[model samples]
Target: MSSNSPADPPVRRIDRVLAFMALGIAVLSVLCFFAIMISTAAGMQHADYATGVWPIVAVLPLVGLPIAFLLIVALLIMSIVRRGKAGRS
Candidate 1:
């Protein structure tokens, strides 16, 4: 007896390639954001110890938010396209 119930599709090679690309982009973005945060913190500490001055608290979102938002939009578009293709089949 053979069982057949429209078995789920295996991961396609293209999907794997795209996944790795997405992962690499995400990791780079995160590392960049972390570096920004660390540098900003170090600057503040240095200012306090030297001149006793801590100016603006605008670093985390300034560089990180836009980069992340753009990536999210890109991923959204990719997913929508993928979904559209799957739907047609």
Candidate 2:
């Protein structure tokens, strides 16, 4: 027997593509954050700075990560809402 339940709507190709993109972004961000944290920790332990560049370089990721996170979240939300609308149609 076959059913036509809303939960059983056929999956769209776009949704799968978007999901993979989001997953990639999440994985990249996690790695980026980990590297930043490790470098920051190392910089703190060995205070052998002459030009004060390490501190500024370390802060760059901390500042940019939040913005990237917000964008990724927005992308996921948009994809979900679009899929919901398509299902209703």
Candidate 3:
């Protein structure tokens, strides 16, 4: 009967799933970022590159994944929070 509870009707079970998925994406994104960092460091230490472009290309995932992940998480959280608030109202 409360406005904040699931019985509010607007905050569907699907919405909760989506929010958790967003959380998962955020976590996975952070993990991948660390993996890329480690790979980059290993590559640098081993000097196993023939072309100099390997380093540049290898570094792209580090930057791109985190940025995209952050955006996705931000949008997802904002959306879920917005929906939750609207449900309350």
Candidate 4:
């Protein structure tokens, strides 16, 4: 007897890529923020932030989080549109 269950929808490559990209950016941003916090807790000087990679570390979460958020929104919209199209067909 043939199974009557509907087949699962295939995940698009773009969706996978966007998801991973958002996750990677969010994780990296959080790690950098934590590193900055740890360094400050350890008595890192203000001047030290200007001299090395600290500036980038401090800025990453500020920028990365918003970008990641936008990417997630885009991914969500894409998913909704894809599902709508599939349902219509």
Which candidate leads the pack in lDDT? Answer: 4
Candidate 3, residue 56: Cα displacement in angstroms equals: 17
Q: lDDT by residue for model 3 over 1-89, one digit each (tens)?
A: 56678634355565576556656655665665666577776665545544665554556555656665666676667666877776788
Query: Cα lDDT of all candidates, in order?
Result: 0.55, 0.63, 0.61, 0.91
lDDT of model 2 at position 36: 59
The estimated TM-scores of all candidates read: 0.45, 0.47, 0.41, 0.91
RMSD from true fold, candidate 3: 5.8
> 1-89 in candidate 2: lDDT tens per residue?
46666555565686576556656655665666676578767674555432466555545456555655665776668767876887788
The 10 consecutive residues of candidate 4 with the worst lDDT sum are 1-10
- Name the TM-score of candidate 3: 0.41
**What lDDT does model 2 reach?**
0.63
What CA RMSD would candidate 1 show? 7.7
TM-score top scorer: 4
Per-residue lDDT over 1-89 for candidate 4, one digit per residue giving the tens place of the 0 to 100 score: 33443533578899999999999999999999999999999998889999778889999999999999999999999999887887888
Cα RMSD to native, each candidate?
7.7, 5.5, 5.8, 3.6
Q: Give the Å error, residue 1, model 3.
A: 16
Where model 4 places Cα greater than 4 Å from the true spot, the runs are 1-8
Worst-scoring 10-residue span by lDDT in model 2: 44-53
lDDT of 3 at 13: 68
